[model samples]
Target: MTNIDVKDINTLTLSILEGADSYYRWIFQEIKPYLQGGILEVGCGMGHLTNWLLGEGKVLVADINKSYLQMVERRFKNHSNWMGGIVWDIQEDPPEDFPLSVHTIVCINVLEHIRDDLSILKRFYKLLPLRGRLICLVPALRWLYNPLDKGLGHFRRYSKKELCEKLTLTHFRILTLRYFNLFGAVGWFLQGTVLRKRLLSSVQVNWFNRLVSLFISIESRIPSCFGQSLIAVGEKS
Candidate 1:
């Protein structure tokens, strides 16, 4: 699946995702009711999700990587209400300068990268207002753990039970947890068992991304017997 050159996944996937309205909307709709006050997107990478939800609300894109934020800053330097991306390391205590009580925080496909996911969840619990929501998306299933996972610095993929236990222990009421991107399971299996690699061509990545987006757009109507990622919704109590 190595054909197209995307330069960087964080920035390039945004273009591929532009055609994936249903996929974004599925997630957007799930978080819409919770989008009040302000939003802090942890590990926002190149702010693809930020750009995806442009003009939606008061948004602050944050990440530990300044280089990544540079790319993101260049992308959204002109939009009003663009709260802008900042350097933030979730594993560390929040910088006093950061507005921690922003009502909403989004951590997308990011928890798996942290070795102490619970600690970070606990931090978010403290950072939000009472009953505030946290949007979490993690790569799902142990079988999907491949070289690509390691290459991108992922610590682990998650099962629903494991994720629920961790968040529940940290005092987050589990709202929703389900599998997403069913077709991508095929690519994951191939990569983990066959190719044993992480490099992806633009065409293959885009095509598979589209296929998974198609499945996830209708994931609500499907059973949870398949897929390669988990998106869980929780609220601080």
Candidate 2:
């Protein structure tokens, strides 16, 4: 594993994980169809998403934090399809032994941390085979860039157009690009922009999780152009 500075964003995620199983399940459902053949999940934080991806196919669960990688390895050690864990720093070149040529790559809520996001996209392009898919999710709306984002080491929030432009520049054919979690935008603005809190309140997360199914139903029916985050599916050309 290459040496890279790992940001301490675990605290920011743990609260959400405490009550957000349904939310994560929804996300998994959205991206499930694209997860086929060999799958490489970048920034497999705490293995919340990794737990779902493990049964999909052969999976390489990776993260910049060695402790997280170890945790994932221990969690999935007995699974036949598990390819183990690696300390992967997206900003750096993948090691020679790294399985860059995978059918699908899942990178969720991670691109914002890298200063050179386009370069990272380009790297993803190189790592995938022709017509391979890259499913990514990142915080949306630059106007929502706040103290929480700064504290979490986010370089910038992304607009749908901005994310598409980056994918195009990296020679990826856009498959799906849209806003997600429309209702959560309000909570994000309240906590991150208005109140300028560095972490989400456990109470807020619990409430959100309780009502997530209803929010998902409403968001599915509406034509929404803005939300708390953007989800994009791009295919290598």
Query: What's the distance in Å from true for residue 9, model 2?
Result: 4.2
For model 2, residues 58-148, the per-residue Cα lDDT tens digits are 8887788888788778888899878888898999988778543479999999999899898899888898889899999999999999877
Estimate the lDDT of model 2. 0.84
Quote the lDDT for 200 in model 1.
Answer: 39
Give the lDDT of residue 22 in candidate 1. 54
> Which residues of candidate 1, in runs, are more than 4 Å off?
1-26, 99-101, 209-213, 216-220
46: Cα error in model 1, Å: 1.4
* Tens-place lDDT digits, model 1, residues 92-170: 8987766434778888878887899889999999988888888888888886787667655678888878988998999
Q: After superposition, how far is residue 223 of candidate 2 from its true place, in Å?
A: 0.7
Q: Relative to the true structure, how large is the alpha-carbon lDDT of every model?
A: 0.74, 0.84
Error of 1 at 33 (Å): 4.4
Model 2: CA > 4 A from native: 1-6, 15-18, 99-101
